[model samples]
Target: MTKNSAWTILAVIGAIVIAWFLVNVLFSLVAFVVKLILVAIVAVIVYVVMRVFVGGRDDRR
Candidate 1:
């Protein structure tokens, strides 16, 4: 191959690798955020349920 062609191929490969890395990083960030939101929702639900059930017992006294 010509010298110019070799350089072009290398540039294309480098760009593809960079793009792949960026995509993976973005996907991982999205997944982490989703997990955090889910955990928060579950914690809130549990707290509400416990308060409803446990707090009423104190009023019976």
Candidate 2:
């Protein structure tokens, strides 16, 4: 119940809170990057499929 002990406890709690916030932010950024990479892979697959199916119809003229 002394003054110095109270300040030390408060400092420890503050450090834990800040660390948690930083970890959450980092995970969110990683998730966003994964989503973007998945979207890009899907787009490339669709493009290749479309070219295979529709890329030969312009030479009959």
Candidate 3:
């Protein structure tokens, strides 16, 4: 009986640790995705600004 209880406790602890790591990993993934989206948004804004300055000029001679 004692051995069985000890095994159960160990299993529960292991499961909790695994769950904690999984949650952390999911959060990190979400953070990374958010950063990627932010970078894309900034890039698009920069491109538009550059186009207005560089590409919208009339060069008719």
Candidate 4:
């Protein structure tokens, strides 16, 4: 293979690798955010349930 052709092939491979890495990183970030949101929602639900079942007593002295 010619030098120019070899360089072009290498460049294309590099671009593909970079693109793959970026896409993986983006997906990971999205997954993490989704997990965080789900946890927050669950926490809120638990808090509400506890408040409902455990009524606060008003003892003003």
Q: Residue 34 deviation, candidate 3, in Å?
A: 0.9
Residue-level lDDT for 35 in candidate 3: 100
For residues 1-61, write the lDDT of model 4, one tens digit per residue: 9999999999999999999999999999999999999999999999989887775554565
What ranges in model 2 sit over 4 Å off? Answer: 58-61
Off by over 4 Å in 4: 56-61
Q: Rate residue 5 of model 3 by lDDT.
A: 100
Q: What TM-score would you give candidate 4 relative to the actual structure?
A: 0.83
Query: What lDDT tens digits, residue by residue, belong to model 3 across residues 1-61?
Result: 6999999999999999999999999999999999999999999999999999998896985
Q: Top model by lDDT, which number?
A: 3
Q: Kindly list the per-residue Cα lDDT of model 1 for residues 1-61, writing each as its tens digit.
A: 9999999999999999999999999999999999999999999999999998988678555
The candidate scoring highest on TM-score is: 1
Residue pairs with backbone atoms closer than 3 Å in model 4 (clashes): none
lDDT, each prediction: 0.97, 0.97, 0.98, 0.94
Cα TM-score per model: 0.87, 0.83, 0.83, 0.83
Residue 57 displacement (Å), model 4: 6.6
- Regions of model 1 farther than 4 Å from truth: none
Q: Candidate 2 has which clashing residue pairs, if any?
A: none
Better of 2 and 4 by lDDT: 2
TM-score for predicted model 2 compared with the true structure: 0.83
Off by over 4 Å in 3: none
